[model samples]
Target chain A: MKIAETDPFSFKEMRKALFFLTFALMVLGTWMTFFYAPTEVVMGHVQRIFYFHMGTVWAATVAFTVVFVASIYYLVKETAKWDTLAYCSAEIGMLLLTLTIITGSIWAKPVWGTWWTWDPQLTTTFILWVLYAVYLLLRSGAGGRGKKARYSAIFAIVAFVDLPVVYISARIKRGISPVVFGPGGGGIDPAMMQTLLVVLLGFTLLFILLLRERIRIMNMETALYTRGR
Target chain B: MKAKLKFIVPLVIIAFLISWLVFAGVRDSMVYYITVEELLEDVPDVYGQKVRVSGTVVHGSIKNELDESLQFTMADGKEKIDVEYDGVIPDIFTDGVEAVVEGSISTDNIFVADLLLAKCPTKYESDEARYQRKKG
Candidate 1:
């Protein structure tokens, strides 16, 4: 209460604005993905799923990056706030990456003639997912707060190595996954690019909204625990 | 610091072990598909061994047999191989599209593929461009 009074930029007001903005962008992004973006020539309608696929993966990437950074900060500062941020972000990242895998498999079933294949990119992504899931499990199973946070922080940082590999594997190695935007990438049309950007922005905003809510709950829990102690 | 070392040591060892396993596994199977040229060159070695090969579907070479089996010539540059597949074909399996077939080569040099996978075009073009290209 005192903190809210002292802070000029009200957290409650900012969260309300973020909620509305994220909702609006998601609606607009869906409309553009379905109606505005032109159908791909070869893949046709199934290619439409690419928008959501990219969006989820993009947000997941941001989430994992936050986990990495926050984990490092937690190690350096030994603060519970950074540890909470890391844990919450990892949870959200796992959710988003799960969506990414499901969307990708759905698209692959139609386009690639198989539900799944262990191509380098897919393999690396699967590894990344399992690594983070293990990090979450380790954090939860570890008993004490200080030791648990410290160990998981180190694990999270080491796990971040796979994130970049998931990205570059398709490019550097031979894989069924396409490199859409980068060196050696086959670029998309301008309209398709616009749609992808919109969806990606929407997903990013959604991620921020979810992270903010999760962090608030986590902080409250920590507060209650300390008060009881 | 000493307490931290207790945790860090095991973490480092575990990380090393995992990375080593991943590296070894990837190196053993890194090439997702053998190119037509490689497959052809290694015909003697790969004969009757289950392998995945990738090549572009040769234009005007796909034929659907009466039994629902499909046959096509897959090409990589000048190197080409005949592929026969009976499984469900991908929606995008067409002339000039890259396809990966998983099967073994018969004694007669034909690839009998049990699974067929087509690569979607990496360069995504709009319907307008497709129509324009069709017209011109």
Candidate 2:
């Protein structure tokens, strides 16, 4: 394969394509997450958040996984690109995670008697939010690239591994998680299941697009750093 | 390179389009609500699936395992159903109050509620939020 040149300001046709596709995906995802799924007769309309919940959580899972790996890779390789990728992934993931919390809270308020709960998963997600907040803080502080990558990577790896377990136990472990496995008998109806699938797919596609754009940006930034030196 | 979204963008779009297709296949599995009488009429269809059952709390049927859990039987004049819950019973859940349970029924005929909701009569307001207006 041909080596990529070091260029700070770069654009790619393929990347642009991906962005457009992602735009389409966002449209499709919103439609499916909102419209395709059937409303709960009991919960009324607010249950729509579950579809968004699934989508954002799925994106969060991928982002967390990337954070874990990139952290390790950055530590070992001490490469700028890996750290950059980790930063981008975490930033975007946290944004989606924030959406998850917001939508989840609104969904819960009317149904769960409050907007927040004391469940392990709910608490963990809150903690993850804090950790990422720390990550952002550390990134901006006056440290060389080496120390920044070393510490943040360690935190990222630890946090990523714990996210899923928290999700499962919280989702399935009744009396333990806020809503239990199936609050509202918490499982999906056939119509709902159908809508949820579409939303999930649309979001998946959107993720692919976003991920590509982020990676490209990382690559371009890496090129500039090498060129400067 | 011509700044164009060529093969790269199309592949991504196609992937998302495919996900939407998969969702379409499973959408029919979604279900809806039916009355207790309707549920009784078609127990086989609703056996162990989620649903919303509405009725009055059978006046004397209230049982508080409220120490550990709470159980009660609800009826819509003609049909009676049992409900058990293990969370803080909403303050509004009491005798003669109207309630709606969101959950499924078991083979033995108890409603395994995941959510319990109740509405109080006369909309009590000894002390109320800014949103309430007191009666003269």
Please give the lDDT score at residue A139 for candidate 2.
77
List RMSD in Å for every model shown.
3.1, 15.5
Span of ten consecutive residues with least summed lDDT in model 1 chain B: B20-29
TM-score of 1: 0.91
- What C-alpha lDDT, on a 0 to 100 scale, does residue A8 get in candidate 1? 54
Q: Which docking band does candidate 2 fall into?
A: incorrect
Candidate 2: RMSD over Cα atoms?
Answer: 15.5
Candidate 1 segments exceeding 4 Å error: A1-8, B1-29, B133-136
lDDT of 1 by residue, B1-136 (tens): 7775675577668767776666666767578898999998987888899999999999999999999999999999979999999989999999999999999998899999999999988889998987886899
State the displacement of the C-alpha of residue A198, model 2, in Å, after optimal TM-score superposition: 2.4
| lDDT by residue for model 1 (A86-183), tens | 99999999999999999999999989999999899999999999999999999889498999998899889889878877886787788899988877
TM-score of every candidate: 0.91, 0.57
Q: Please tell me what DockQ candidate 1 reaches.
A: 0.61
- Candidate 2, residue A227: Cα displacement in angstroms equals 6.7
lDDT of 1 at A55: 97
